[model samples]
Target: MKIKTKSKKVNKAWLHDHVTDPYVRLAQKEGYRARAAYKLKEIDEELHLLKPGQLVVDLGAAPGAWSQYVRRKFAPRDAAGGGAAVGALNGTVIALDLLDFEPIEGVHFIQGDFREEAVLAELQAAVNGRPVDVVISDMAPNLSGIEVSDAARIAHLVELAVEFSQQHLRPDGALVCKVFHGSGYSQLVDLFRSSFRTVKPIKPKASRDKSSETFLVGRGLKQQA
Candidate 1:
């Protein structure tokens, strides 16, 4: 007789859902680390962020898809538009996350908690005293299912990202961060408005319709100075 176990049903259900997930198929075909790449790509298309030979900082950049996009975008090209060798001093992308990620071409990976001062210092040092052109934070707290607590944690992280942007971004740089629409959402938008010349909230097509997550883009950092 075959043995029955409760785990089998759960596993089957998970497999079914994963298999039917459109993003999963799309990611496989496109070679993105996660479906999240589409979200960044959509935002970039709308905002025209990311340029050749610019300094970019990516927070919570594990899996390295975003870094991959950055690398391709800044790949060396000749005046005739031929693919050229990437110079040692070309554009730089620094990816930071608590989880380990395999290194990608043209990306410097730092495995550490972004909340730590040491990690931030190392990232800053990597930039070699030059202000970053763009900062993207995809950081999200582990959900506990407690609405208020989760919102607070998310808000705190957004605040930390804001503070980092204020300190490290160039006057004309930009910041894009993931935020959930929950308690303190409006206040967070207000804070960003005060800090940046323009604040635009974006929801990418790659994002699940049921999700509360949105991306806040702060532009024209020079206004604060």
Candidate 2:
């Protein structure tokens, strides 16, 4: 009885906060599918990582808010960049996720788990030997509340993202990976530092204040061979 009551209170509190979130309201007004778009926007604006005519790979990209943002940036537009919603896109966006979403204009979507070898092969084939300008991964494991196991899953996803970047990203390309602040956080940062010439850790305001999530941006890959 006590547990049920506590759970109800927690749900109510979360709902209230989500309803009043400014980013959520802004996302709806601007035609984004989710509030997550602004998180990537803030990160992109800070680093200037996105540009027209670039080939971008989005991993764990369900719902596709990040891909949408990149699509808009690639579109030739007026000063506000709101002139055209979906027209001729100048860039390539390949998105992969385990869950399916309604198709977006000019985005190639692959539905599969990224951890599987077959899925990885499909994603690589989609690249078609093009120089990937950026590899953005928002992959996250279903949390079980066991810190050790959860941390391992998180680390594994980030490691795979880094490895893919090493193989596919252009020498001057960048990688944006989502990571939580807990066990193994520092190791991920170190991995990024070792692989890229420049590594930055950014915490976007659009991310909830209570969330432990942060982003690691690694640019300009180091020589591997």
Model number with the top lDDT? 2
Whole-model lDDT values for every prediction: 0.84, 0.93
Query: Could you tell me the TM-score of candidate 1?
Result: 0.87
Query: How well is each residue in 10-67 modelled by candidate 1, as lDDT tens digits?
Result: 7897789778878878878877788788888899999999888899999989887777
Off by over 4 Å in 1: 1-17, 78-90, 222-225
- Clash pairs detected, candidate 1: 171-222
- Quote the lDDT for 94 in model 1: 91
Number of clashes in every candidate structure?
1, 0
Candidate 2 residues 15-86, lDDT tens each?
A: 999999999899899888889889899999999999888999999888888888888888876535742458
- In model 2, where is the ten-residue run with the lowest total lDDT? 76-85
Residue 186 displacement (Å), model 2: 0.6
- RMSD to truth, every model: 3.7, 1.4
